[model samples]
Target: MYSGIGDHGERAAFLDARALIGCRHRLLLDSTHPRVLTGVSEDAGVQQRREAAAAHRMLVRDTLVAADPERWLVIAPEQTAAQRAAETMAAMEAGIERIWGGLLPQELDTGRRGGCEILRRDPDRGGYVPIIVVNHKVTDPRQPDPADFHPLTTELYTWNPKPDKHVRNRPQPRDQQRLAHLYRMLQRHGYASPALVGGAIGYHFDRVLLHDLGPILDDYDRRYADRIAVVRGELPTVPSKVPECRQCPWWSRAPEEGGQSCEQWLVGRRDISLVAPGSRAEVLRRHGVETIDDLAAWEGDDPDDWQYEPFTEAIVTARAWATGAPLVRRVDRVQVTRADVEVDVDLESYQEHGAYLWGTLLDGVYRGFVTWDPLPTRDEGRSFAEFWSWLMEIRAQAAADGKTFAAYCYSRTAEDKWLYESARRFAGMPGIPTEREIQRFVDSPQWVDMFQAVSEQFICPNGKGLKKIAPVAGFSWRDPEAGGEASMSWYRLAVAYEGGEPDLSQRTRILEYNEDDVLATQVLRDWMTDRADAEVPAISDFGRRSIAE
Candidate 1:
């Protein structure tokens, strides 16, 4: 059991007990059930990641045991070997040493100094650099900095699900802001060693860090002094209308069964985000307005005021929340092109890898193209090609028959972004469409973004995401924990080829998730069409192929 331990897997930088209080305090404080930290879900994706973490820890422990079998006798005598391995890895993952120095690794001498989980000794800098492992590709990295981390750190290490694939070398601007602070802190502390970043793409090492520790580190000290307040929760914990709030654990159901929800306490406080993100919410708050009723009292029927739309939405949402009903505002109708035969599309992608699955619904059946191989390969291109050909063929058939056809995606920006990016990466592939074709298709009236469509017509109270909109439209996912985050976890499991080949059940869950995503769009379309002045019925022929109920 010990000799054949597998490699430690890639997980998010913060996923333990310490991080809950340190970096993510706002979310944790809002959580009604603290047990969410340890509750195990039956979600296939969650289970897959849990398995990966355990396997990776076992591998690391095996390596430690193999190196010095007798070392643990002195290092951890009271606990069994298994207990020591698990606890140590947990400590390493959480950077507990920065807080408590008791459980430092005895065998690894040069590592785990100055706050970073030691990757290795830095030959160039003479001191160690901190390492951070993220679950996805380094694209659009958004993380709060650890102010308590050691100042001697240089470039932090980061890797994704497909570590072997180097999607891009540049860290995001926000990350650069963080690295700048870390570098400056080290210099200010008189460590003065140049910081660098390196990570493994399989066995291959890439000097992936781009920010120069020298120029950027100059102002880190002054900035970091100010930085502590931003993360320290100096600002009031008021709920905003941001998308992240919709998925925050604070709003999640109680961690334990049959307990109160984290969001239950704030039942009457209205979301100030209805107006917008900036000065508008402040204005509303200043007027002693904390609920939709306040907005109604202050509102006037001024033709020129931009607040009209917001006021209208607040009223509708307020009534629905109070009465346990759904309300659709009729004044704000949007013009969305519709056809008898329409394609409902949804794309499932991992930031580390390009779009891997494209699920489409047409002719009353769900047609999906799943790319199993890693990115920058022909595997993803095949999915694009297969979907495009079938879509164009049916579209031509509809054109000849004098019937209209169109494509409707829940979020236009998401689907269009993936389509264009995939075209750019796999331009030379035979099955894929050209960038020009994709651009033309996007511009065409046949392509509809349901998000924009919904926003133009009605203002939803809860959120505008498919998870909220689809349920109201009478669509539900076939599987539990059928969220984007959960799907990514499932994807990792679906593609696992190391310990054992993936079985049918693993792949089936992923397919079902994608299929459900596309079907939800169909439901939304039909609902909207029904609400339109003239009804256009969507296809009733949900194809023969269906996800297991």
Candidate 2:
């Protein structure tokens, strides 16, 4: 099984654990068009995440080694994969308790080569189990359960384990499948642990989150097999529009060998995937409706035959796309909730660290409640409290004067999440409101989500994002490069998260970006109220069909 084990050599970095979780077309590109993938550089956000994850792995390794100095062996990065694998084998044979940064022998049969963050020697099984340390949370604090874990030792409490673990109800398929990949490699090298389980040390290094590999083995096998097929040209790589396309390296780059970019290829063919959900698009393709033109021109009455219901919206969107229209009004007359006193609000955070800035616009004047301190700081509460208190005061004053009052945000998801989170985290802090008060404010009709309003009354052919829709309302940001992703990079620089002199200019840029965001919501609400009827085309004008339930 180990013959020519390292012949696959160093596997491309792109084909790592993410290949199983990310877009398959990207995997194919990584194998065949590696030059194209390499041409694309990592953005600031991606860089920040990579750094944070690396830092987390180091911390976990250090903690484990500190606890049991004699038992832990760390494989040096300077060695070749074969040398590291041999060293790892010797350590395992010698019965080392834990191995850090140990590269496993390649699974040449599948062209898989990689290393685990830590290979924990299973005392009962006589082999090592893989453990990955990541920056993101694996468990949900919101849904607490009896967790079974060894906090300081970073081991799983298997038998008679305490039921104190709170597993995230949401599936973390990426992490699970990754463990399966490593498990397969271990098996190939005759290092397979009898216990078909792996662990992940997430942001809350309080305990290792254990996962049984049995359930995900079949799934991982299928995904890996299919990806290998595509890589070997046994299967074709078909490009389809997906949410991941937004971050895909090949999304816009034209191949040096002369071929249309992924974006160009999709748009040129007027691919149905561009205008419809992936599942719906696949169903549409099976029904001989492969392109947006086919979808727009399709006149079939019973969409039930296509095996996907409620297909009217996609058809309408395709028609709008064909007509070069940004949006089509669903309602005969667009309406917006108006108030004598109103505030447009926007929040900015530094990549899950915490919300650091709350920008609000009222009466054409912008007031920014900002924390200059780095995030995950107690000062986040100060900024949030200041913003909330000021807004509440405005509402109270408006009520005292018998004037209607409302607060508008582009989307309530991000804002509402942070609001409740801040209240809960800073419960006892001065100026912080109770969770109930935050809920009351969010639940109230006066808290308007303009994005929801837009969704209810319009069919945006392009997209419904603030940046995408705001231009239609005659609103634009002062900074040419202003965007949510761009702001992540700016925030990193502004705060100097990677250790450097903080760039004050980036702070100014972030403030301007936030101001524009609030201003966009204000203008959008105004546009929907005053000019939507005249400016936006009615859905009825586009040969509207009956929508199925």
Candidate 3:
């Protein structure tokens, strides 16, 4: 059988024995194995167990080799195979221990570096063989105490019965006799004995034999039984005035004797007000305030207010003092309106491979755009330098007009930053605008009108995100269809490329996709403006308010 041991040295020995002499029959021992102490202390003890298991495995192989040079043995260290060996050994050890306690001797050194002895005979000769003693060092040396082991049998049964009740309730004479006979047999055999005598007879026997038996076994006299004891008591009975009796804890108290009137004795105690606000005597007060009638009559919001209302602790305490309970108040709902604006942006590459992205603001009544590309090529001559100067002039004009520069996604802006930084470092040129200036340009209030218009009209059911709601807002694209036609977005196109045939070049496809997106944004803005005019009356109201304010 395959045995998993932590002792690598012992494992090597086992392998050597199998290789040198063909000994197929083997008794795999993993006495101080790490697996045996699963969930044990993680310090030195666990490490020690692992090392010991490995060492023992190798030692077994060596012992086998020394005992029989001609015998051949094979040991597999695979997890599943090793686990099977461990399980078999565990079951056998459990059976032996349960029946015969300390009769089996345990290994002296149970730590990681400890050794264990294994006995096995040769298959061909069938005679006494040399015992294999294997030692494997622990990787970690600390071990835990035995008391930490979790118990197996608790909360097994309920409703233990008394002996007198058991005798009175047994419907069948034969069953009662059988139980008595079993009890007598248990008295003869020791309770620790694994002979199955106590389990065979007694109340358990009745449960096995009779399917209809209710709490007879559970209610039987448990004190005299050899097994665990149980407690049994009668179920409580309800009185005629059930509701009143259920609420009264003293319902089980003894009744007062006649002639000596209980009325006299209960007079001062009858009105023992348990409802006092704060005192030891509060629980004994019994002022009549059961229904809401008493509460409404009392002054202040405390008595009239509902106790379950959600209020501040201070409010609750004040209410309780004033009226002895919580007070409820009406809650108002706050309305918030949200809006979004999608701006069409263009990115122009002045140098062959260098580019700068820009944003075009589309307000309901105005169309203003900003361009900010700088010349990266030093050899491009005066035309490129002039173009760069013109772009910077346009940016200054936009800033003067209160317009903000914004990117479709922050990652796009980050890419621009990286490119700018690299050019400054490699080409010995100054970095474009500082990040603070870029942020200021992106967050200007000049685009507020456009933002409000788009937010109220173009945004989907949810407030944020454009990936899922882009098309729904009338921004159409040529997304690929099932068979293999060109689609609008990269997502749909990628799916088509994967599932169907792809004929277009990657660079061309990307350029086309980006252009389509830019155009869609332009169209979507126009459509959203039209929709606001036709559908949302609140848009005009908001605009008028903004102008007036």
Candidate 4:
């Protein structure tokens, strides 16, 4: 019956179940169709309840008739003193034969064969009919005692409060009225009683209803003893109030003070002042000079007489005053500056093979030795010898001046391979510098200091290799877009060489390209040093501010 009204797919199995039981039955369906069930009735609530009762009655009558056809007349409803009649049914014999009934396909499977056979067969003639009821509704937890045999009803009721009348408009009054009505109905008919009454009551009536209802329900328990039981759903708990209610909007309106609102009180508040260039504000903003800005301003070239403790004291005092909400300390600012220096530089390139020198040239000085090897061999390459000689001369000049000789190549592969191979070839050479000495020469302290100072002063947008330090020193260069006409990669040069002959023209082209690279590097280096000198004050100021922060 459930399958017939619930889903169309189970219709076949439902019919088979009915056939197996050898009895006709009517499906008592719940009419959820709103239009037919709910019409223009003034008391629609009461009418709906009646429909539910009618449906239950029809289902009970049908199930009792199906249990035993011969006993149907004996159990049929008879006329009573009242206008409406009530029905009474006789129980059918059971021990004759038990017939199992279930949705088919599943009940007819091999595992269920025995149960299906029992459902089809008749019971013993003098036995009581066995009743099997299947309900899919969620069971109410607060129900009658499991040991009781009487039927019970569990219902969910809702009530909405109104404003005018506190007594009648509240949830308790309505709930009590509903409960009283149900109790009377149960008393009129000796059928069964409710084991429990449980549901969420409105919050407004909680205090009033709980005080009265909790005791009333408990009294029902005491009176009924084992006959019936009554239980009510638990009320929800409320949270505690926070102590920081002064900052909460729910407490009150805005304050009279002319400042930020309560919501903005947590945000930071500070005052800033703009003064002269060498004033307290400006000096405190220097890169290295933290606290006292003009620590070395009055000392000039003499490093002595510049007490560092006074500057430290000034900084500590200023910070304390600022933290106290109103700043107080102030000082006289003095400006000290450095002069710009220009250094001359030149780029030189050479080509050599084995022990014999081939070609050499200096940037802007075209008239120089340009030797070459007519016979080209892997072991007798002119480029290698020339590179070795050039490196030795550059290192000697760098050592005398206490400066580092930096080489800037176009790409990582080219520069890395040249450095590695040159070091390997000169490992045992008579005039070559050892690996450690060469590394020390490259890592000069003066160069490191200069580079670090300049890098912190400005931004480098087109930074790459040795050119990254250029923009920071206020110098700029024109670097060709990568892979463009002026740009060259080792792979491209190698491809050209692989297809060419070992002639003078090819060697000349290679030498010219290498020389051009050296010249560019020299020009960039000179430009960087000059720019760095001119931008020293700005760089120093930036450095000091960074330290203070």
Candidate 5:
């Protein structure tokens, strides 16, 4: 029925719960997948506990039953992994301390297990005939194979709870081919249209699917030996860290933090993926270079090879890491014009979309972020116009005062990319910065990218990310994890501005994060200016200001 899992930190043979729920490809791929970060997040951890608690209350009692032999089974005789996980937690507010499920090999081999949480059986007979798989994820769970059920069963249904406004129901992907393969079709039914989870409770009846159980039984048998070996700690997994590891639960808990920062380890990882999709980072790894150092060390040995360009790029990346500076190969003294009047900008946005708010620091005075009431998905509303007009007016005044206008930001990639995107998106909006104007503003000498400036001079560990480097620049954040990602989460928690009324608490946090970002640049700028000491390059490409001509 299933593999066995012993109690807390106990070693015993067990099958992973996912192997039962996953498609065949996902099963095989995940089995061999590295332990590094793969799509795990703190928010997701919170949501799972919330959903599991809600689901636990929904399915635990004498729930429902129907005689259709396809849909309803109120009470299940077996406890599922989801239930056990929920029970083991101190409370939903408290985190899921750990994941616990599956049976010992003897009980597991009894042919009654899966990722599903509940198991129901026919009244006249015994054993599990239908499984109600409870998934806490917002998306609907995929349908299971008929063979995974007991020979005595006759039906199965996926029971999931989600946060949809109920405009659409989650369940009812009949998937007849998968259902047909089960070979117990009283009829082919997809139930494709989802009505509502709330409506489902009214129709529960007692019936079960006793489909072909042979394949799953064989699957269990095939996996038993390997399962035992894993329990015995005979298998060691080397993690290949990906971008997802930045927020992964496992990475947070793992003893070793081996990641991109480790050049030697990073360059050697190459894992092919299919069912478990790989980020395919191996394209760079395939070039026979692993770390940034390796790339930097290439002395034009393979001039004719295709890896040259990537190698060249890697040298810059490695040197930047080594020195925390940008443009390592360039010997030019990195300098930008200093003036009495300075403008520093930071934008906050939903990463899935364009900027919602743009904040600026003016002459060391915080001017505040500009955003419209009821944030638009892509429109450059009045607030953007207001912000731009003021910026232009300031630029004019600074020029009139015989002082250069040095506009600043920490990183160009996000702030630079977003401003142009917003400009292009709102090109048709009257009084808004046109796409051309946005480009002109970006190219102007006023726009100084501190990130690029620092990278040219410093090699830093933990990468040259602003949060890490900001402290060195004598800047600090009041919030624990103030980042672009954190701000997005804050945006969700923050109330939207309504009819000129702002949500102060949410607005405050957003502003705080933005201010810290802008100030980090200020610190960096002051440092670079002070460091210039005897010589400052008369001209800098920080922003060419060809537009000023």
Candidate 6:
């Protein structure tokens, strides 16, 4: 579901487990429509993640096999679906302790067929259950009393047996939902364990995450029914703009290129979803505000007493989108925090790996501290320490000159996370700041998040991302394809992430991208301070104009 995957050249013969978690429009397209490859290619970050997950699964399988070779039945990828199912069934019938990479028998009634990462026989319940191995981290040591299971044995424990393991507050809903789907498939084949539970082995492969299947199955049933309804024409298969559109194969090029893209279709209709999310668009449609033009022309007064607090904000955003304005002011006067000695900062990293590049812009000069080594290496600390030292020197010099100082980033969340993380990870290293020092700097007024300022002071119709908003400030990256995703792709080539000869030119490309990012932040901050009040239309202007109309 997350990957937007389906069979090519055929109407969906079966709904996979992913169908329980992803976009409905995507599912419908994948089910009913022939595949159309577009400009949306998988970025290096996604490819790296997929490879990492595959590696983790192999490591776990190897570890299990090394411990007890006889108790495991490993299904070969070379086997056809029929062959896999037969082999899996034979293993289950023989009470094999574990079946690695098993393809479950298809359920003819529901048309659901999929492969399971691991199918473990239950000693207590007399049948098999599903266990998934994933790349993402499932839990952290933030809270107590997490549901834990033995990584190798698949024995579950409600409380954490280890002190440094806890359940994350945020749930992994996709993992749970997929497990529920697989559990139903197991039940159909009459091989489901009566225990009503499933397991997930995440990036931290030391333990398995145990999930109770009771509530998860209930939710899965509802989602599966809805998807099946949409497939059977019991529901509308209307396309809406969603975050998932980025990964969808059915999504095509711009409408002006004579391509039949979902985005182009929405643009032609001036669809509400073009300016608002799917849920919000549905709400506006219910109120008879069906298009961006209609929304822009709407008065603040609600005829039906909907009491929607965001009604005026939505209308203003629509107006901005319709008029092709970068932003419409949500406040009376634009306010931006500025300083005499200002620095714009940007960091580049490869996926969830350590930050390898720290680019800074100060006094019309760009400086970059970068490491060429592949990530998750000791060398990351050297670059991080050098960047920190340089930044501190600038800050101290400014203080000595009696100049007020401020460091700016488009978004502080990423920078702040890496700042503390780097400090902690390399505490004993030369020139590395302590966590306390990092916290003091982050908490001080000198650290400013320009993204927060923009979000608070303006209504950005398109997006609040630096790439989107920086252009409004007359700033553009030299690289036409400059973006975080593009930078990750460049970083991979620059560092030889997958064991090939490194492309040194890609390193130059990444530095240029990082420089542009920091420059964009600086440009955006300057625009907010010097020109935003005179240039952007305020909310009051809309109100007065509406009264005149």
**Candidate 4 lDDT over residue span 68-160, tens digit each:** 655333222234312111222111122222222211122211111110111111122222111122211112222334454322221111122
Give TM per candidate: 0.61, 0.90, 0.24, 0.25, 0.48, 0.88
- Candidate 6 local lDDT, 102-159, one digit each (tens): 9987655566778888898877777887989887777654434447532222333222
Q: Residue 532 lDDT in model 2?
A: 87
lDDT of 1 by residue, 51-122 (tens): 554454344445434655543321243675455545544543443322111122211211111222223334
Query: What is the full ranking by TM-score, best candidate first?
Result: 2, 6, 1, 5, 4, 3
Q: 1 or 5, which is superior by lDDT?
A: 1
For model 5, give the 10-residue run with minimal summed lDDT. 191-200
**C-alpha lDDT of residue 358 in model 2:** 90
In candidate 6, which residue pairs get closer than 3 Å at backbone N, Cα or C atoms, i.e. clash?
1-18
Best candidate (score: TM-score): 2
lDDT of each: 0.52, 0.80, 0.29, 0.29, 0.46, 0.79
Report the C-alpha lDDT of model 2 over 1-549, residue by residue, as the tens digit.
112314356433223466777776776776776566564587656777888788778888888788777877999989987899889888877878788998876555566767888888777766878888878877655454345442212343232223334444235788998899998888876777887887787777766777789888999999987876767667887788888788777888765578888899999988888888567677777788888888887775746655643567678888889889999998999999999999999999766678999999999999999998888899999989999899999999999999999999988999998999899989889889999999999999999999999999999888889999999999989999888888988887898877889999999999989999999999998898889899999888777542221
Q: List the residue pairs that clash in candidate 1.
A: 8-56, 45-490, 364-543
Candidate 1 regions with alpha-carbon error over 4 angstroms = 1-174, 192-248, 253-261, 268-283, 300-327, 330-335, 373-377, 532-549
Model 2 spans > 4 angstroms off: 1-15, 37-40, 124-126, 143-162, 165-167, 301-309, 544-549
Residue 395 in model 2: shift from native, Å? 2.2
lDDT of 4: 0.29
Query: Which prediction has more favorable TM-score, 2 or 5?
Result: 2
Query: Which stretch of 10 consecutive residues in model 6 shows the poorest summed lDDT?
Result: 150-159
* lDDT: the better of candidates 4 and 5: 5
